[model samples]
Target: MMKLDFDDWNIHVGAPHPFNARAVPKIDNGTERPDPRRYHDPDFMREEWDKVFARSWLLAGPASDIPEAGDFFTFTIGPESFIVVRGEDGVIRAHYNVCPHRGSRLVTADFGSMDRFTCPFHSWKFDLEGRNLAVTDEETFRPEVLCHGHDLTSVRCEVAVGLVFICMDTDVAPLSQWLAPILPQLELYDIDKMYVVQHRRSDWGANWKGGVDAFAETYHLHAVHPQTQGLMDDRTQIDLWPGGLSRQFVPFAQPASRYPDQETVNPGIQSMLSDAGVDPNEYRGTAAEARHTVQQAKRRRSDELGLGYDRFSDSQLSDSVVYSLFPNVQIGCHPEAIFLHRFLPHADDPNQFTYDTCILYRHVDAPGYRAPAWMGLAEGTDMSGGTRPEVVHTPLGAPPGLGEVLDQDSDLLPIVQAGARSRGFRGPLWSEQEGRLRHFHAELDRRMTAP
Candidate 1:
């Protein structure tokens, strides 16, 4: 019996690779067990809203979602709703969604195009830049009541690497500083050129932090998402940076170390090869080498198709480089496409949160260019950016249509939430594999316990 090359489950264990070496440092996040109460306690949730969400630069949506002037969308966090719109000046701005007159919500739709926002109740209109355009019966109101100027309250809005971000704390650091660690790597994909092909939001019965924890680590993949074992490597390369940011590089187009057969090219690997324009039957390497082979093939195919893959390293071409943006967003970066997942806290309930998933793909005229098979985009998805799909809202118990792995997470997370409330459950005993979770909770503790 021959010992396998990956039998020890240790890969990328020594020095930091050139790709992520810049962000990796010897910052020690103490290994204290995280309190389970933070997941279900209402008071803790409230504290997070005040300290964490309120102060952090949150991902609003992809900038590609609103390309033209007057294009707008809404993002709600806790009790506040924001209108993120592209002004006529081609600047992206965020405004409080309330009408100044009576606090009526100016826009109810998830996305729309409008020259100005008009309140349905009092018919107060505001321009795309959120300036007051018209106030119905303006003479009736006293000047003192309108002394503050009836403009929609604006927040700090910034665009970086093709994503829109808004921060309520005006004094907070610039978005670039907040995203400094991962910005350079994110730029390699040219995500700004990509367009959203699918977007969906679903209500889940779990605290927002709990939802973040679930997606932040792959430690639970063996138990919760067994189906992915054949396609994903559980031995992930975890990298931590300052500001609660972390990422895991999970090898794709390969089987986990625990898989019984390492030599066979499974269907998942075959699909990956086929998507990269490689013929599975012609593949002669072992399952582990499929990733590298696909990387080479993708580079060759990309050059033939005139697609951009030169900036990306070979590993990035075949692995899942998922980055967890502090507080709420997880981005899975790829050369051909990217996956954006946001876990938004429910306004009133600590035990409820909204899970938003958006799949973006760069359009290429070459028929050979295909997004990763793992993206699981449904048939007839509009990759051309001609049509922005309406946001689909799935109820708490219904299917989120987020494909196999995430839908499995949707089903399992609420159960985990329920277990967290049990008297016997003390706290999570995180392993080295779950360092990202520990890193996130450490940052959460730092913010929540700050003076």
Candidate 2:
């Protein structure tokens, strides 16, 4: 018999980050169940934005999305708008979206290449470096205010793991410092080189935190995504880190303990074997043997296809790692793809929020490669679709092709939002699995009052 270690690949695994030295925090204090008003109260939403969203390093967009100079995207959080663009020097920067002359928006489109940005209202112009180049009537205004470098108010911006992160607080720490604990896991996969195969955004009637609560735990999967019960281990192992970061290492291709008759091959195991290039119908082993078999099969398959995943251990080949960034981002990292979902507070409505999801892949040319169906991909469908990516926009509750598992969550989240108002409902009760949610709110509280 063996006590299998699910992590550590026996390769050049680096020492744990200094922040990971302590044990993960528990939900012991009165902080377990947060006050429900934080979800739908207008004042609370405003307070959170001022304290959390305004100061945190939020995921703006991917650097790969804006590769060439002049490539840019608009990220709107709360009432503020920012433009993330590649400067002439091939560096990425973010600037406030207001025109210096009349306070009108400078860039109007979601994304595009522009030689420079010109305000539509007064035609004030600025280059990609946010340098003021021209103004329709420069002589009309006082020279002091004019010479004050009205270009575009530059906001704090930096790049990490191919994603652009911007902070409204100019004095905020660098991205690396803000995200130290999770850096090792991010570098494990060379995500900066990956391509965005699918991008989606939807407006939901749930508060931003409410939306975060929904995706933060796997406890809901049994009731909401019943179809996945037999395929994944629902009882997950969670790890918490400093700077309000947490991770849940989810085991895949294994049946839940709830499933009886573990010795015989189940349909889920059979499907996993067949997808890994093993003939499940020809497999002479029991269901319990499927995980080991699939691991070896995928490793051999990766070598045969020339996929460059030398840094990944066999356990990482099929298991899923879900990471939660403070304020409002949840990511599911898999060997095949990175599932990133970002939630933002609705500008005016406390009960509404917007979610943006991006699924990035390595863009390998292997024909036998298959993205897991849980990714909402159909059989035989090319995940790349020629690798030229385009984000599909849908209102909340629409099927964004994220597979049946999350599709169920999409349909039920709105109702969950409405349920928050029921007088009969108390605040959330924390189980050990949902400790990440408590840690998230604890950080928010700390930041709200922390000098």
Highest lDDT: give the candidate number: 1
Clashes of 2: 2
lDDT per model vs. reference = 0.86, 0.76
In candidate 1, which residue pairs get closer than 3 Å at backbone N, Cα or C atoms, i.e. clash? none
Give candidate 1's error at residue 229 in angstroms.
Answer: 1.4
Backbone collisions counted per model? 0, 2
Kindly list the per-residue Cα lDDT of model 2 for residues 63-173, writing each as its tens digit: 888888999989887888999999888999999999987799998777888989999998889999888999888788898888776878988888989888999887788
Tens-digit per-residue lDDT, 200-282, candidate 1: 88999998888988888877888888888887888877778899998888889988878777888889999999988899999
**Most accurate candidate by TM-score:** 1
Q: How well does each candidate superpose onto the true structure, as a TM-score?
A: 0.95, 0.89
